[model samples]
Target: MVGCARVVNQTPTLPIKGESYVVLPFENYTETPYAGYRVASILEGVLASKGYNLIPRVWSINERELAVEEIEKLKESAVKNGARYIVHGSVNEFRYKTGLDGEPAVSITIFVYDAKENKVVKNVTVSGSGWVHESLGTLTQKLLNRAF
Candidate 1:
């Protein structure tokens, strides 16, 4: 069996490097519990691996969607942390489909918010499916790595 993954869509320009960023937990819209947090953790690792400076913060709420108030709060937190950018978004899908192969599918949208400007600088949506033998987390990481 062969495992495969592909990026569905993404913006042409990447976020500038050498800027400090604060990564907020992604909102989970999937049936799978804590899917947002799971993806956020993976994204943090990916950013760190790429040598991006990350500002650590503790988020107690597990948001299921990105409400306007939530976004404002996230922006405020990013500004307080002195981060140039805020990273967040939502997980639209995260699960293994019901089929003979049972492929692991993941769909997520990422947003890069400019803390100083209080605006979203860039946004990208990417999705992929893994082979039957592959794991969901591994596939998710692969797809996110392509976001930048």
Candidate 2:
């Protein structure tokens, strides 16, 4: 929320125009890591199609390659790879529940930060009851629009 800002409610769509960017894998907070990675891959492809530069996350740490014992070592490696804008995204919580109220509930939160600015470029959560699944793609695209 500084120099320039805009929000486009179209998820899973490419941008009309702009600068390049790198989209990091979103941290999966669900019961399965696979679910998290699946979403990340989708996000990556969408952004890539927009002509933004992207950095593959696993190419550096190799998933669990760095433990608490190797923080320092990994730092150097990440830098050597010529990373400028590091995308630290996460899906901290996802809940789908149906109770006595007979209404289903689902929520997904996505965050994108600008490494250089050291500020949260975008922070928002999308939620709905039944049929919320249809909005996931739309929500992600909305996040990316603000991110770039």
TM-score of each: 0.86, 0.49
Give the per-residue lDDT digits (tens) of candidate 1, residues 1-148: 5656667676677567788897887878899988888888889899899888888864654545456577668768777778899888899999999969899999999999886777788899999988888899999888888886
Residues 18-132, candidate 2: write the lDDT tens digits.
Answer: 4334444455565534434445656677667767676555333245322333533432344456444444444543334445433323234555444455555554454444343
lDDT of each: 0.83, 0.45
Off by over 4 Å in 1: 1-5, 60-71
Could you tell me the TM-score of candidate 1?
Answer: 0.86
Any runs in candidate 2 off by more than 4 Å, and if so which? 1-20, 59-79, 92-107, 128-148
